[model samples]
Target: MKILNPFRLGLLGGLGVLVAVGIGQTVISLATILTYVGAALFLALGLDPVVTWLETKKFPRWTAILTVLAGVLGVFTGLIFAIVPVIAEQVRNAVQATPRLVTAFFDGTVRENVETALPWLGVQDLLDGFNEWAADLDVTTIGGGVFAVGIGIATGITGAIIVLILTIYFVSSLNGIKSGIYQLVPATKRAKFIDLAEQVSAAVGRYVIGQGSLALVNGVLSFIVLTLIFPAFGLPVKYSALLAFIAFMGSLIPLVGTLSGSIVITLLVLLFNGSPSVIAVGIYYLVYMQLEAYVLNPRIMNKAVKIPGALVVIAALAGGTLLGILGALIAIPVAAAILIVVQQVIIPRQADL
Candidate 1:
């Protein structure tokens, strides 16, 4: 008894380690469920403003919510039906046109079209540029790139289905969900928490609305532009329908959104529509992005969360790191919420202190 009971202490430590391991596994098991919940919560917040607006015009809350959900679900279902054929055609075209795209651009026939599209680059220079760029390209790398792209598209589709299912459930029970959350907070701070939560929610809602409007404009314009440009260069725009959705997702990230899209757009245009059309698409984005940054943003997000450009970039990167594309899409709104908390809560508390 006086020897310090080393065995008992060791046994207790081992049990503690086992408990910790059990807790970690529990968390890992819950991750997928949590992800679905998070997606639904964010989507419901995004749709809340439209629901509230409908209510103001004398609609019942349930009616407004259901109407919004129905419209979203209907449009998404229709879009999938419309895009399936287009994507199939596009992939087939891409696979078939790979060789022709390389030769046609360098053949001097499309040079005038290229010059007209981007006056900054001469015809010879454009082909020469591609040649110079391609000098370092390996056939293996191209094959891998195509494979990776296919995998990404497949994953995005699967994730979209899960999100759609979860979003409907969350939107249907959003009011009850919020009330339940309120009950979780201590009574002493419940009212204050509700007020803060409302403010943050409104900020996120506005941001989501603004971002969605921008994405719509981007996607529609992409479809129109690609459809018009592709045929002019003797290529097909049969898949232009699917291009809209691609542009929509690509436009969600703050700064890098268009850049990431440009790579895909350029590759597609170069491989199928020729480099001149790629330049046309590039020029279109160059102009559109400026208008978006200056005009559309000011009008749409005038009352939304305001953050610096650098912070937007950093938040998008961090969120993308944590949760993939969905994180990048919602990163701005999250950053905005944090900013609101800092201004409304932390700074005031610090001042009182």
Candidate 2:
């Protein structure tokens, strides 16, 4: 018998492992694609009530779909028209006055605080270094960077449009797609899986509708408050409504949503009227957050997502860590699915035993 070479055997084993890993990665990518498809289908299901109502009045399916799409597009276009100009004007003003704001702030407040807090600290030297650094900073260079970012955002928007188109296509044929999937499962498991899928779809649909309603309410309230308060401070009132609307949309996400909204609003405030406006914005956000938590959230989200607060936080953190923003967005639905499986399948099975 010829002796096998150990080195050759070892190399072959490593190659096999690499091939397995590649295959596993490919499967994961495919699964992720399927998940996205399923999510789109669920969104369509959520919209089905509207579609059905239209059909009852003798509207064709295609016409109803077109109507829905048109409505969505109109809303988005109106939002852009309302918001972009205000933000642009505020940003321009902020950039022009940054140096003066920094000089006044350092000279009047920061220097005094630093000296009082730390007698041994070289407050004047630190201020000099900060001023030197600020002087060296080129606003033109920053503008160039912002322009590059705008280009990137344009590209991303194009990609998003493509994905939305695909999602619409998939959602339109959700029933057919689901039937095809059902046929693939073993006869014994098909019914169970179908039931599970329905539960998950319903849960996701409820969550989306509930959240959308909450966001709309929050946005309208913020806009009213900002419009009332901004004029008193000599800030542009027209833009405050736009800023508030943006903040409301941002507040749709779980833990980070309100914070992200606050950051955007704070920046806009600071841009328009410096540090004092920023401070006022902060107070507004704090009050809004408290009201939202105690009143708005409980009333809106209670029935939609029954998961505990701690679980929501954990799921959001884990999803954000594993898959970034998309993960965080889908985390609650995924958790709800798991909860359904536990309550419907595993627990019942155990009880039977």
Candidate 3:
């Protein structure tokens, strides 16, 4: 301070700038890192049972890790190959038929129904505004937008792949990692922290496995129902599976996701066949939701994640509001993790004190 060292001043200034930049960039990087870490942790937790079994059987940790990674890769590849083409075809057909669907719906009996029901609602005015908006949306603009979205999806997929690789590595070394982390804690606190971590890991793992099973059941049930109903309505049969899959994915989003999916599917049905089909599809979804809420959810999810219905809805809404689809997908698991921490650590610690 007496000499006012220029070198020290420069170093301090550089450090300040770096800290500013980190703070500025944190919002962008925070979500990405959280997502990757959450995914990896969940994956490791899910495979913990298998790892334990392997250890019991005297399998080397590296070998068990390789086996788990291979299984995961195989499942992912199979799903991609089996599902992507069907979805791609449905998307292509849906795009091609959009104008026809719009024309038919507006020109046909549906228009009369809308006119009658929504006379005061200015339904036609809304359509007119939509048309105006569509007119302003040129092909080049739409195409450019689609291209940009495609690039973003590709980048996301690449990031997911990297995360998956990291997950495998982390899972393989989970024991070592846990030991190292515990060592950093005071000896008195280490055991409690380790126990809390295990509880959290178990909660998240069970939730993931349960959700996957539920999604599969939903998908299968939807496909069966759509396949049966589409033919009676005289819509394109080829798109049924694709539509069902979309609905299945959407159902994973908790509250609003199913509703959004139902709307999209109903529109597709209306586009191809008519309003009667749309009404039928709506009825089907309503019934499906009832069954899922009452039967499937309780039977399947109860064992894995015992979240309250109100909490699930609240978490889903908050997550969707904050981060869109990805947020919604992860909201339940995050809530489960928090619940475990509260039940196993915080509450007990408070009680002890």
Which model scores highest in lDDT? 1
Candidate 3's displacement at residue 206, Å, is: 0.6
> 1-353 in candidate 1: lDDT tens per residue?
56598899999999999999999999889977777778777888888888989999999999998999999988888777887677778778766865765566667545655565557756676677878889989999999999999999998678778888888888788889899999999999999889989987887888888878888888888887778765676645445665666788777766677667756766555444555456666677778778888988777766676887778889989988988877887788899888878888899999999
lDDT of 3 by residue, 1-353 (tens): 37579898899999999999998789677877777776677677777767767778988877877887788889888778987777887789878887876776667555664554335657677778978998898899899999999999998888888788878877888888878888999988888888877777676677767777767777787788778855665633447878788787877666676677777887666546554555667688888878877898789778877888888888888888887776776787788878878888789889999
Question: 30, model 2: CA deviation in Å?
Answer: 8.9
Candidate 1 regions exceeding 4 Å error are 1-18, 99-155, 229-239
lDDT of 2 at 48: 57
* Cα distance off (Å), candidate 1, residue 168: 0.4
Write candidate 2's Cα lDDT for 77-121 as tens digits: 875786766767756765676686667565665455344444687
In terms of TM-score, which candidate is stronger, 2 or 3? 3
Please give the ranking of all candidate structures by TM-score, highest first, separated by commas: 1, 3, 2
For all the candidates, what are their Cα RMSDs to the real structure? 4.9, 5.5, 4.6
Q: lDDT for every model?
A: 0.78, 0.73, 0.76
lDDT of 1 at 74: 89
Runs of candidate 3 exceeding 4 Å displacement: 1-34, 50-67, 99-123, 135-144, 228-238
